[model samples]
Target: MNDTNIKWDKIFYGRAWIANIIDIIQTKDILQSFYFKRYLLRAMMAGFIISIITVFVLMVKTTFSLDWGPGLVNMIGAITFSFALVLILFTNSELLTSNFMYFTVGLYYKLIKPYRVLNIFMLCFIGNIIGACVLFGLMRLSDVLTPDMVTMLDQTIETKIHTYTFQNILVRAIFANFFINITLVIAMQIDDVVAKMFVMMFGVTIFAFMGYEHVVYNSCLFVAGLFYEVDHLALWPALKNIVASFIGNYIGGGLIIGLFYAYLNDHGQFKTHRNK
Candidate 1:
């Protein structure tokens, strides 16, 4: 942790966390849910926008690359996506991965209510769909994707998610989601660019490499995939992906990391748990 942020913050860390927990809990109320919903909606919209942009960027990278080595290609893909992280962390945007720490820490300190953590999840998911659905509509109307490219993206997404069975999906998501959240926390806590860049790079790279499911990413991809005339990716497959991914995302994010953070802060000290 940065020493400069400690002097005053150390005394308030406990209080700050508790406040966060409270905010989370308050968000759960039927009347107060709107606050959390708006945040999630905005986050989902941002995520959708980012995903569309990433696809375009990837199109350029893949089309332009000259038979690059797998190592180089992997690095490019990882680093390219890190752009989203920089935006979210710097902009303080909500992302499912980032939520792992945000709410958990709050629950730990009793700053925010614990139940509110999951509230954001549902809202964000719904909001993300709203945004993605719009993007999908635009893509379908646009002549941008040749029928072939549409098929390609869908197949890729399907292949990525289908690698895991429902049970394995949940299990893989747990660890992958945990690391993803921790990655954001680490990035936020760091100041240097090069270091933060690697944290961003390696963190996303691990998730992509592991083929863990990310509902937000897939949501947009699925929409675009549908627009692009992806074959064999019908309603059933789409529903399955959405439903399974939703459960997995929640389990990985809310149940595992969020609760774990709550446990740590609520019970003991809020120290680093570097799996070293």
Candidate 2:
């Protein structure tokens, strides 16, 4: 076959990117329409899993930071932290960051309405917060917050809230979800479980190690801080970071990746293929 006639999906070893995007929209439609309770539960589950993993990452980093220092500690923490996304994806949990891309694509194709998108976003965000709070309460009850762990969390929160400029947080937030959703989009076109896990780990680790802001992860951290008597954590600054991260994540994932891909692949040729 000529290059122009090549079956691109075969080259990708799975469905084409546009096909994957359509599949995501259809799958989400069913869940959102008939199984919304489950959808909300999955969002909460994602928040819970991330919160638990964040604590473990802080604990591990705290233990190693003294001997390994910041660079190595961050690398280790990043790698360890990545498993949270892996778990979330495998469990079919809903994450706001990835959803930013998914729903944006759905919107582009007129598969979902704007108001419904906003509703889903709000529901996922609120559910994530609820999940984070529940995890914090469980940790408190279990008495798992050690002095070092608390200290680590406080320091982390301080950097996120007080140390960085608003512009810095915004940029970092953009890159964070950009990496995450890019990984998700590519992973959707692959079939191997191990490959998907590796892609997720690599993408998450890059963002974590770079100290990029993620809205959901930041929410979990902030919730933990509220549960504890943290020295450096303040309400206003935390809110600022959250707001900046939320906007930046939408720009990066929804506009940059989702719209760009939809526009690229949903032109005349793909529409004709779809009609066929």
- Number of the predicted model whose TM-score against the real structure is largest: 2
lDDT of 2 by residue, 1-276 (tens): 466576644553223676777787678667867898898888899999999999889889888988987898989999999999999989988889999998887787777779888888888898888899999989988768888899888988999999998899999999999999888877876789999899989999999999899999999999999898798888899999999999999998999998877776653445543433
Q: Could you give candidate 1's per-residue lDDT for residues 116-230 as a string of tens digits?
A: 6566656666666677777767767777765445555766766745555666655666666665766754565567988987787677767765657766676777766665656
Highest lDDT model number: 2
**Global lDDT scores for all candidate models:** 0.60, 0.86
Task: In angstroms, give how far residue 116 of model 2 lies from its true place.
Answer: 0.6
Give model 2's TM-score versus the native structure.
0.91
lDDT, residue 226, model 2: 89
Candidate 1 achieves a global lDDT of 0.60
Show the lowest summed lDDT stretch of 10 residues, model 1. 267-276
